[model samples]
Target: MNLREQISHYIPYTTQETKEQEVILKYMDTFDNLLARENESAHFTASAWVVNPERTKVLMAYHNIYQSWSWVGGHADGDPDLLQVALKETKEETGLTTISPVTENIYSVEILGVPGHLKKGIPIATHLHLNVTYLIEANEEEKTTVKEDENSAIKWMELEEAIEACTEPDMKVVYRKLNDKLKNYK
Candidate 1:
C-alpha cells in the first residue's frame, strides 16, 4: 500500500488520538504533498522519539525553530515513505547509523499546529503537522553530532527529563501520552 494509505490504516493506541488521526486523514487530499503548505496550513510530517535499549532515555534536539528541546524528526516533503522519512531524519540529524524500531506499529500521531518560523532564512507562516510519530531505539554510548543548521544541541536525556523538556503547549499533552504509551510498550 502507499504511504498515505499506510497512515490511514494505522490504528492509534488511544481512541482520542485515533479520532484525531482520522480527522487528519480526511485532510489527506491537501496533506499528500510537499506543497501542502496551503498558505500557513497543515502538512504531513514524520518524527520519532529515539530511546535507549533499556527505554529509559530519549534522544532529543533543541529545535531552532521551536526554541525548545524536541523529538528527532522532519517533514515528509512529498515523500510517501513516512516511516523511512522518520528513520532517515534520525540518521541525518543525530548521525546515528543503527536506530531500529521498537515495533513496526506507529508510536503516535497528531495534528500539530506549528507556530510560524523562519526556514532557510525565509519566514514560514504558522502551519500544521498532520504528524505521525514512531518509537525507535539508539545507542547512548555511541557518539552524536549536532545538525547545526537545524538544532543547536543534541543529547540523550532521561525519559522523564525529556518529558519535562517539552515546552510547547500542545506538545506537552502529546509527550505525556507518548510517555504513557512508551511505558506500556516494554
Candidate 2:
C-alpha cells in the first residue's frame, strides 16, 4: 500500500521516533487491520499539525480524555487515507471549514503509548498508536465549533504556547517535531 511504503520510507528525525520505528513497523507487518481503532492491541491514528494561513499559529484541542491541549486527530477507523483522516478529524473537532494539506507526503510518524482510560462508561486498556502526522493549512477567520464529546475547546496558538499548553510528556516530542518541521514548510 502507498501508506505502508510511505511510512517505511519516512526517516525518523528524532532518536525517540527512530527507536520506536522498529516497534511500529513490527506491528505494521503483523496486523492486517492495523488502522482500525477496534484492533485494541494497537492501531494507526492520523493527526494534524494545523497552521493558520499566515503560518503564525497552530490549532489545538482541549481533549476530554487526555484532559490536556493536543493536536487534532483520531483513529484511522479502517481507512488508509491518513491525510483524509487528519482533515476529517480537524473539521469534526474544530469545525474549521477551510483546510488543505500543506503537503500530501507523510510529515512524521511515531509509536505513541495511550494510557488506560475509561470512555463511554467502558474501560479501555492501555494501547499504542502508530500515529501519523500531517501538516494542514487553514484559514484563521473560519469559525470553529466544539466537539463536546471529545474536546471542551479549540484554539489557534503560537507554536511555543501550543507546545507548552500540552500536559502530556510523551506528546511533547510529537508536537515539537511538527512545529520544527512546519517552520520550514512553505
Candidate 3:
C-alpha cells in the first residue's frame, strides 16, 4: 500500500449519523480512493492551536481564499510525523519559533475537504488533516509576523469570538475541546 492508502487506513470515515456523512463518505469513496492511486500527488498536512498565555485568547489567521478567520497551519509537505507537521506549519504561518505547549496537552483530529482550485478549476482531492492541536505559551516579547502568502492577516482574538468567527463547524468543535482542556489550567 502507498502512503495515502496507509494514512487513509487509519482515518475513520464519517459515520451514518454524522451531519455531513454522505458528503464525506462520497468523497472518501471516490476522490480519496483515486488520490490514493496517484503516487506523485498525494499529500498530508497538519495544523496547530497557538493559544495565548492568558488562556482567554488564541491566535488566528484571516485566510485569503476562504476570507474567514481560522487557526495557523499549512501542508506538512514531507514531514512524516503529524506533530512535527503541526509545529512546523504553526511556526511558518505565525513566525513564532519559541512556541511550546502550555501543558503538554494535545487534542483531536480534524478532517476537511479541499475545494476545487480557483485558478485551475480542477477539483482538488480530499485532504485528511490529522491535526494535533497544542496549547502553546509564548513570551510577551515574541514578535508575530504573519506570512502574507498563507494568510491575509493574523491576530490574537478572544476565545469566544474566535469560536464564533470560525466557518467550519468541526473547527468550532476543536475550539470547544481546546477551551475545555485549558479550563484545568485556570
Candidate 4:
C-alpha cells in the first residue's frame, strides 16, 4: 500500500482540541513564511509516537541517513499541511497503517538549520516543525513491515531506554517532552 493508504489503515483521526488547533495554525503560518524565504528544495516533515501500552514501549526507527535512532517521521515535500506531512512521514518510515495525534497535547519543535543531507554535504535552509506526537496504541499484529530506504530497522523501546539510546541532544529533548506528556496521558 502507498503512504497515505498505510496511514489511514493504521491510525484513526482524533479531533484536535481548541488550543491544539490554535498552535497548529500558528505553526502553519510560520511554515508558510519559512517556505517563502527558503529555496523551493527545502521541505517540511512530521513524525508520530507509536506506543505499546502493555509493554510501555515506544516504536522508533534507526535512520540510515542520519545514523540515529528517532521516532518515525519525514519531510512534507509539497504538502502545505504540516499534519499531513507528519502522517505521511510516519507511515513511510514505519509501515504502520493507521495513526493519529493525541489531541489536546501536541508538541511543537523548532529545529534551527542543521546539516543537510549527510552524504551529499549540501546545505539546507532552516525549517520549522509543528510536531504533534501521537500516542498511538498498536498491537504487534499491526506493525507489519518498514521501509528500508528511510529506516534501517524498527523496534519498540522503553521510554527511558529510548531516551538514553538517542545520541543527539535535540532528539533526547523531544523524547523527554513526549515522555512527560505521556505521563498525564496515563
Candidate 5:
C-alpha cells in the first residue's frame, strides 16, 4: 500500500497520534516532495522502536545532535516505503544485521518538532519530521556499534531505563506510549 493509505488506515494509539495523523495526511496533499528533505519546512522520517524478543528491553542510540539517548531512525530521503527506511536505519545506526519488523503495519505516528542545529558545521533550519514509527525486534545477543556521524554509543536498555536515559521530555512520553502498546502487540 502507499504511504497515504497506510497512515489513513492506522488506528492511532493516542489523541496526539490522531491529531498528528491528520496533519501528516494534509501535509502529504500540501507538499510536492513530502518524502524528501528538499521541501525544507517539513519532511517524512521513519523510526524504529527496536526491542528484544521478550520486549523487556529497547535498543537505543546516544544521538550526537540530540545529546541524549534516542530511538534509531532517519529521513525517508524520497523513499515512499517508510518501513524499509526504518529497517535500513535500524541496521545502520545500531550495526545489527539481524532485525525484523514485528508487523508490517505502522506502530505509531507523530509530527515531531526539530530544533535548528548545526550538523557537520552547517547550520540547519528548524523543521518538522512527519515521523512514522515501526516496531522492530532484534537479537539482543548481536553486538551493537554506533554510526559515528549520527551517534556516539549504542546499547540495549531495559525498557524503563531506556525512558529514563532519554533526556528529551516529549520523547519520554512517546516512549512510554510505545512501551504501553507492547501489551497489546504480538
Candidate 6:
C-alpha cells in the first residue's frame, strides 16, 4: 500500500498519535516530494524500535548529531516501503546481521520536529520527520558496532534506561509511548 493508505488505515494508540496521524496525512496530500529529503520542510522517515527476544531491552545508538541515545531510523529517500527502510537502517547503523520484524504492521507514528544541525560539517535546516516506527527483534548475542559517522555507540539498554538516557524532551514522550505499547505485544 502507498504511504497515505497505510497511515490512513493505522489505528492510533493515543490521542497524540491520532492528532499526528491527521497532520501527516495532510502533509502527504499537500506535498508530493515528502518521500525525499529534497522536500526541505518535511519528509517521510522510518524508525526501528529494536528489542531483544525477551522484550526487556531496546537496542539504541548514541546519535552523534543529537548527542543523545536514540532509536535507529533514516529518511525514506524516495522509498515507499518504510518497513524495508527500517530494516535496512537497522543493519547499516547497528551492524547486526540478524534482524526481523515483530510485526509487519507499523508499530507507531509521529510527526517529529528536528532541529537544524550540521551533518558531515554541512548545515542542515530544521524540519519535520513524518516518522513511522516498526517493532524489530534482534539477537542480543550478535555484537553491535557503531556507524561512527552517525553514532558514537550502540548498545542494548533496558527499556527504562532507554527513556531516561534520551535528552530530547519530545523524544521522551515518543519513547514512553513505545514502551507502553510493549505490554500489548506481550
What is the lDDT, from 0 to 100, of the residue 89 in candidate 4? 74
**C-alpha TM-score for every candidate:** 0.90, 0.94, 0.67, 0.66, 0.98, 0.98
List model 1 lDDT by residue over 1-22, tens digit each.
7766777788787888879877
Q: After superposition, how far is residue 130 of candidate 2 from its true place, in Å?
A: 0.5
**Per-residue lDDT of candidate 5, residues 1-186 (tens digit):** 899999999999999899999999999898889888888899999999999999989999999999999999999999999999999999999999999999999999998999999999999999999999999999999999989999999999998999999999999999999998986786
lDDT by residue for model 4 over 1-186, one digit each (tens)? 432332323321223333444544455545553323243333345567777756378888887776888887655555545556666676777787766554423343434234555334655543444343445556545754668777788887888988887887877876876676576664
Regions of model 4 farther than 4 Å from truth: 1-43, 119-132
lDDT of 1 at 176: 77
* Segments of candidate 6 deviating more than 4 angstroms: none
RMSD of each: 2.0, 1.4, 6.0, 7.5, 0.7, 0.8
How would you encode candidate 3's per-residue C-alpha lDDT over 1-186 as one tens digit per residue? Answer: 433343443323223113333333344455542222242233344567777777778888887767778987666555545556677777888788888765433343444556544523645554454343445665535777878876877788887888898887766776766666567554
For model 3, the stretches where C-alpha displacement exceeds 4 angstroms are: 1-43, 103-105, 119-123
Model 4 lDDT at residue 11: 24
Residue 71 lDDT in model 5? 99
Q: Which ten residues in a row have the lowest lDDT in candidate 1?
A: 30-39
Q: How do the residues 43-126 of candidate 2 rate in per-residue lDDT, one tens digit apiece?
A: 999999889877779988999999999999999998899999999999999999889998888788888888899999899999
Of the candidates numbered 3 and 4, which has the greater lDDT value? Answer: 3
Q: Which one wins by TM-score: 3 or 5?
A: 5
Residue 75 of candidate 1: its Cα lDDT?
82
Residue-wise lDDT of candidate 6 within 1-186, one digit each (tens)?
Answer: 777888999999999999999999999888999999999999999999999999999999999988999999998999999999999999999999899999889999999998998899889999999999999999999988999999999989999999999999999999999999996775
Whole-model lDDT, model 6: 0.94
